[model samples]
Target: MTDLPDDLTRFLAGVAPFENHPDAIAPAARAIEIRYLREGQAARPDSGTTFPEDPWSLYIVRSGAVALCDSDGRVLERRGEGELFGHPIRFGQQAAPYTVQAVEDCLLWQLSAVAVRALAERVPELEAFLSSDPGARLRRVEALRTRRERLADLGLRSPVSIGPDAPVAEAAARMAEHQVSCLPVVVDDRIVGILTDRDLRGRVVAVRLDPDSPVEAVMTTEPVCVDQELKIEAALVEMIRRGIHHMPVLADGRLAGVVSAGDLMRTQSPHPLRLVRDLARASDADAVARIARSGPALLAGLVEAGTDVTQLGRMAGLITDATTRRLIELAEAELGPAPVRYAWLAFGSQARLEQGLISDQDNGLLLDDALDADGEAWFLELAERVCNGLDAAGYVFCPGGVMAKGRWRMTRHRWRETFSGWMAEPDPKSVMHCSIFFDLRAVHGDVELAESLRRDVLEQARSSEIFRRFLAAGSVTHRPPIGVFRQFVQETGGDASKGLNLKKRGVIPIVDLARVHALEGALPEVHSEERLRAAAKAEVITERDADDLVHALRFIADIRLRHQVERLRAGEKPDHLVAPDALSGLHRRYLRSAFGIVREAQQALAQRYVL
Candidate 1:
């Protein structure tokens, strides 16, 4: 074997197939041959004079870029610096299936097929990486790139501890010495409770309690704790949901350390907590709108950083939730306190915490049953203020008038009656309403009102087999857009002509399917992924089917999110329509696979419901 150039060897060692196998780098580099092509020049056919008997060689783009095009000259994929192509020829193909043409003047590294195969034989992973389906390879790459950061990755501080019987003064002194705000109360290597600065101020100073009192008196017993392996994003969600500033981190039932809101805010690049704080402090609708405008940019950054699609949606929903709560507070300040208890409800994507870059508002109000003519009027005014404020903050009113401002602002009894009527009637309009309303979640105020209503709704849905069937039938109505020949059925005669409506055709069907299963199982979860998981746990759906639907939903949603981000960057309004050409060849293939999964689920739904 010939010794390779130092720069070439370094570049080869840095990329995949060789990056993890250092020994293979030298042999792989020894087989290298360099070739350059001018702008628009096409690589010679594999069956040409060069290596005519084998007619196969692997080509890597060292600089510039090239396009892999099919027979019709449609680009199948694009490769740039350090990206490799021509792997197909090694797998028993007599010649390359696609034409490789330089989009610009390019330098290429060429390796003969015999040498490449020899390298693959020596490194099993290299063969797997080279021979696997493009879609599968893409998924593996994406999974590694977007894996959520675990709590252990944060480099958390060693927990400062105080025994439950320790005096409050000692706990405070220990906190001061460590420069920490909280302490975990441990007994026999077990965390029994947690104490924060707030607990000290409120319990000791405010109440004039003796500083010599035991720490257990001021500490919160059996406080919420998270595993050290928990995702940072999930931990943040839990803290925000529970309205906590500090939480103890546990590893295998032993107190490992503590994580605070400040820690999460600093680590999370999206700064969701900081954004929520800003929204909470906004004085008026304009200030809220200014903060809301920054969401797209933050989302774009997350997308660029390869944040998981699920996390992206949750972050977006958190911002919306904060904005809505702040708007409600501002509304109350202007309209005076509410005359009766009320629970503001969110429906559709916001309710499911799956909101994308371009989501319209879908919300309603559930008021206390004791409301009279006067109270109703006051609640209506409050709804109008908040709904208009949300519109100004970029949530935008639902075209269907589902906002709390109008008919949707109903007393608790009326809301229950409405849910009952929908299940009882099961008309087309009722079914459509069920699709949206069934995903209801309480955004603010009296949560019990919403929970009670949800319980009744679930009971009614589960008891009424006819209603479940109606839901199943409705779910299969919007099938995925794969045609008879397995080609994409592009939209026609619109601004997005020839593009795919990823939301309607891809995402909604899966959502509807998950909803049907959720209703069948009476699952309390509103998020689609959670609903699917719960349905599987309840044996309403097979785990395999649930897993498929989950993956399908994630992939479709990811594509939709990235598509919208592209539009935002290009100064265009975001929408669900995505041009197939815009996707890389691997993504396009995976999209088809995802759509196929949806189609299969829809078929099963149709057959199960006898639709």
Candidate 2:
């Protein structure tokens, strides 16, 4: 321990993947060897190379330069001494995929494969850095293997255009010939409008607008556009938010090309903004309903795009909430005004922005206190009509009828009174309601009013140790599935060997723990990951522990999204059920390690909550 370098020791801490391995530390430190690249011994592109079975080397350039090259003499990437390389070859590859050449005299750390493995066993950080999917591997062998460079090769082509003044018939013909769904309408070299197939169906065809009329008359006047140099992720987020069918990609001042939702869907870019745009464009409850149903599909795309799980859940929830609100808005327009001023509160998954492909409506209303018997009658009727409308459109009613129509959940003052009573003397039932209602987020109407109630509840919760205890007890009720004998516990039922409900067991524990922490700390943040981080920063939880929880949640969320995609492709419904056999050997190991992080977080939560 005295001989070990501080850099090596510091790097080993909080490495979740290999944290539990008994021999994880010493072997890593002992096996690493440092060597200097000879002054003139420069390797080059297409240079002949020696093959080794497992003398895996960690090449850290100490000085000068090095180039990663392919057999065709193509220079792949250039690297400096402070950077590490050769990760791809570490897993027992007989030959390196690309040759590494010394551009000048250099000092290198040639950590042996045996040492790397030993280090991985000892250092969770090293193990995670080394153990990545071969197909998905793109670690820094050189600085040039960047996403920006990869996107350039994707080569978005220049888009075809038409003048807004051009006849609709001519524009339609051009669109048909090009076999594209959209065209940018330009006027005097400036883009003025955009036209899409949906617009054609909804407006032109439905209204029987003459095709011979000017395209400008029917074209969407304000088109959503993105700068060509913007990252694909940014662009996708924009598209989702705006609910546009096409985005005109502009480079400098010129139109480069167009990107559509279909193009993005096919590529599986983790652009939640695009989904937002799709939701925005939804014209009716039925159309919005269909688009809302694609939440899991969008989530899968986000996972494939390598989105962080925190962001993934946040985006997913936002989309779902938006759709639900849209349905409510449409219903209000169709039916009539609510009997009084009311705040529609989305409960459970929708409130948390955690809805799956198939989710039931879990919403209730907060009505103004002016209501008497007549007002009550009006609200009851309104709730029934809106919920029925939502059901007809797609969302199934909550089996327990937790909607606004419920007599127990109808009035705003009653809700406040209920919270006050629960806080006065916390019980199991009170704690359960807090668990559900604490996660409440207002989706539509008088948001400030909904927030006022939340503010009141948090105020009462902050001072009550008993209330916090009940909340913590409820949170720890669902234990992580780590086994008594082995480090992990797998399924033993019909789907035994298939993955357990990662959400229910691993992720939700963290979520619930975070929720408890938030309530105890009196934090107002609604997102679970945010609540956890905020709690940690406020000294309610440790920084190291928070980091573990965040990473574990992201890893598990990534796995869940991938499995959801597989199910969707197989024409099966997306689910929390994951088949372990479907996972690759590497992924299986990752999944196991990821869950271990969850276990640690849960244990920490239990200790802190006094559960």
Candidate 3:
């Protein structure tokens, strides 16, 4: 190979996909051709008359800058020094959908498609970085920076087992012999129950049971089990959320091993668990608020670690659940126990287990039908205490007054009647209420009351075709903000005038689409992804369409999360607004594609439901 210019070689050595591979820098430099353009020059004109038409080339802005514009000349992205452009053309696009123009006098380095292909063949990392798929680029970054260990990587040994018919003495003897604290009770190679030291001490030894009693007599049945493929961080989250010390691990539907809290604690950070524990022991609402204040910081750390978006949401939900439960406990202690059985119901994202850092309170109180006027007054006081406590803990009061304090705190019969009336009327206001209240889950108190209400809601919604159509019509109105020629339609007023409402314009459209299908299929799922999957299984939507919607939802959610984390780290309150210009060229393209997917799903929904 011929010697390259010294300056060019040095610059190439500093660029990514080449900086780490010093040996490839020289060859890459050899293939480069330098070009210059005056201010206001179009690098690739719409007529394709400025550059060679045979083999497209990639351009690196060595100095000055350039703007990528849509067909009508609206700026899509601005590229500066060290940033590469014209990747689409080199990656097999017959012609670029957007034109690249020099925003100022520029110095550029250009490499032909053939040479770029040769370099990619030699460097696998370069291949992934240069791929057209945004997911490939994301995966490369995650693998290099934030790849987490899976349960299998912990080198867990096969669990010691005891047959369900085995005597209590034999089980204890086996545990002592193996130095294990828990035993999976197996029958026909399946785990039927679990026996722990706690069970022996609390159930058998404490009660003075016979030593010859069968293991199944005291073992806890239907124990929680985690898959061997689960990430260490996720396993720790589950353990902390459930307050369990030992969890059985399954591989391909059979018992593989057992992971204890100690095992996970050694591998993962103790911050989240410690926070939950502190919340549990919190003496007052102020103490709970103080401990819960660290939630955003904890979430920022998780985002920095490249945790999956779904898991990030799950972590946030856990914090909110713990805080809410603690506040309820404190309130009950102060205001005295409820005069009637009631369930503290969570609506919207919290109930769906997809809460973000910028969540508000959306809850109601479901009281037993046996309540009288005196009991109602008592429950009202309880509701006020919990709502006020939540507001003080940073979940601000709902502007729409959807909290449990007022009309929402109703008896079971009233709730049922309200649901029935909403379905029967199918008016605009009723449809709006159905959207929020239908996605309810019991966060605390009598869960049976919540479950009963859910069943009635589902049955009524299933039979009411007109109500479903009204819901579909209402949902289709929140379309993704994609304009003609595939550009982002940004918000145009107030504080978010320069950005797009990612939560409303991007995430909620998919959420609504999945929800419509879920209701049509009578699915019991609350989470959007779960609803999509369940709808697919019920044949309410094609599997391919379900998968596409899921991918779109995750991609948009990931971008939104990263954006919020950035704002949070900068000491600003996080919101759903995101400026298109703030995103990298690659992310902009993928986000546009995600919005397009949502639009297509909405159109299909409109046709199917005749909205």
Candidate 4:
């Protein structure tokens, strides 16, 4: 093994892409060249060398600054220490598309494309770092996120499956024999449906259907499935989204394995789910509140266990839902059954399944159209008890009175009118609430009413161009707090030394852009990551930009989540403000990159709408 120049090896060891792959360093360092440049000096690729499959030079800026430029000398991207510039060109007529020049006195290492390829082959992390694929780049960035073992990383068992033509009694007997909660129903060697314990109980046994009937009668048709390569967090998202317990995993168009809620639960510590189950079993509002109070400690524990901030928010959201549901049950017990069907609507973060350490309640009530005044009053009573219970439980009451207990959130008809009105002629104030309200989802009760309301909002929002413009303007209301020099911009007088509120500035900009793009594309997704995906699918945003935005969103959120966890551990009240100077140079780099992406999106948003 050849030795790397001491300084160069140390820098590579510190950089993200190469940090995890220490074994590859010797081979990489051996076939590399090193150079130092004074300020304003330039480094360009060999024009005489063959284009692309040729060994293009790998340039890693070791110190100071470097700027990539065109052949005509137009500056492209600026790079600092530990930043590498070498495009992975598949088929191209070029000797490196970029002209790498040093903008500041610099130290850099140059490696042959052959050596880089060897390094990539040796290091899985290096491969994603060096790949030009958007998905690969996102994965590289997401690599910084929680390091939980994904379901794909697990050794999944290929469970016994039966054809839809299998008799119900045979399926039941298989269940008894195997003790699995669900089994995939296959047709023509592809999964067509799934049969679960719930399906058998609800569709066959409870209905008193003939046990000898074909399994197709009891199987859930066209079941939602996940790819075998999907993240465990993503599989969790699918289950939560579709309300399914078991997911069939497909590989090469064949059923590879099945994952249940229990299987996915193995990815995390059992504590959060245990807390939720305990919450559900709470006997009264006080019990529910008591369980909710454990949330901060639970959040801290999950963070300590290295859960991704995105998943942490979702876990917190599940806890919130459990607390609310238990409180609602207790409320119902006290107020008696309502006269008509109603939905308990959660707006803002909870609705998006993106709750955090501290959140104010943003919810509404949707009543049956047939509900009389007495029915409305009974619903209000229930809402009041639940809302007050939540406030007592650590979720602060919305100062704007967005809770269902308020008159503004009283009935389904009125809520429909409110949504339709906002989508039609969104006033500034309504536009302010649009991001929060448009994300409304049913927490409990008759979800049909909530779904209909969502459909109405989407339909109106799609056609209402003026509403979209106002909404876009509202989206950019909070700008990322990066100054002209790509430094943190802080409130000069109050909390100046502590630095910017990362949530309001860095995180919210990404959220706002996702919201506007989602609305413009008529996407029904509420979560920021999902909305970006939906927008990309609709071509409302480029796939590259979508990946960038999602990466940025998660990066900023990771910072916020970690900060909140630290605050909770310190027994101090947590807030959005964070000190940039306290962060590592790499994190500072991430902050700059994330804020830059957000600014680009903001520019795109402005170009799309009148601001």
Per-residue lDDT of model 1, residues 1-611, tens digit only: 48678998888876655666678888888888889999888887554322123445678788999877766777655667766777652211123367778899999988888887788787655543554243343455456556668888999988889999999999999999999999999999988899999999999999999999999999999889999999887887777667688989999989889999999888757677777778889989889989987887887877777778887788788788988999889888888888989999999999999988878889999999899999988988888888888888888889988888978989889998998998888888999988999999999999998999999899899999998998888889897887753468888786768699999999999999999999998989999999999999999999877887887888899999999999999999999999977775446656766787788778877878888
Per-candidate TM equals: 0.80, 0.60, 0.82, 0.77
lDDT of each: 0.83, 0.66, 0.82, 0.77
Residue 25 Cα positional deviation in candidate 4, in Å, after optimal superposition = 11
Residue-wise C-alpha lDDT for candidate 4, range 1-611, written one tens digit per residue:
36657876777777756666678766776777878988876664455222234455577777889776655777655778777766552111122465666788998877777777777788775655555443444557677555756666877886679998889999989988988888899878888899999999999989899998999988999988888877776677567545567888888778888998888767666556567768988988888888889888877877787777787788788778888888988888878887888889898889887777888899888888898888867877787898999999999999888888886456667877887778777788889778788888898999888898788788788889999998888888788887653456875665555777887887778888888888887788988899999899999989888988888888788888888888888989878777876676556655766676788788778876756
- Between prediction 2 and prediction 4, the one with superior TM-score is 4
- Candidate 2: list runs displaced more than 4 Å: 1-126, 129-284, 298-302, 305-308, 356-358, 392-394, 491-498
Judge candidate 4 at residue 57 and give its lDDT: 52
User: Ranking under lDDT, best-scoring first?
Assistant: 1, 3, 4, 2
Candidate 4 residue runs with Cα over 4 Å from true position: 1-139, 144-148, 164-169, 197-222, 241-244, 271-275, 304-306, 419-427, 492-497
Which 10-residue window in model 1 sums to the lowest lDDT?
A: 88-97
Segments of candidate 1 deviating more than 4 angstroms = 1-142
Best of the candidates, TM-score: 3
Candidate 2: tens digits of C-alpha lDDT, residues 327-372 = 6766677667766777878877668755444567778888788777
For lDDT, candidate 1 versus 3, the one ahead is: 1
Model 1 residue 485 CA deviation in Å:
2.1
Better of 2 and 3 by lDDT: 3
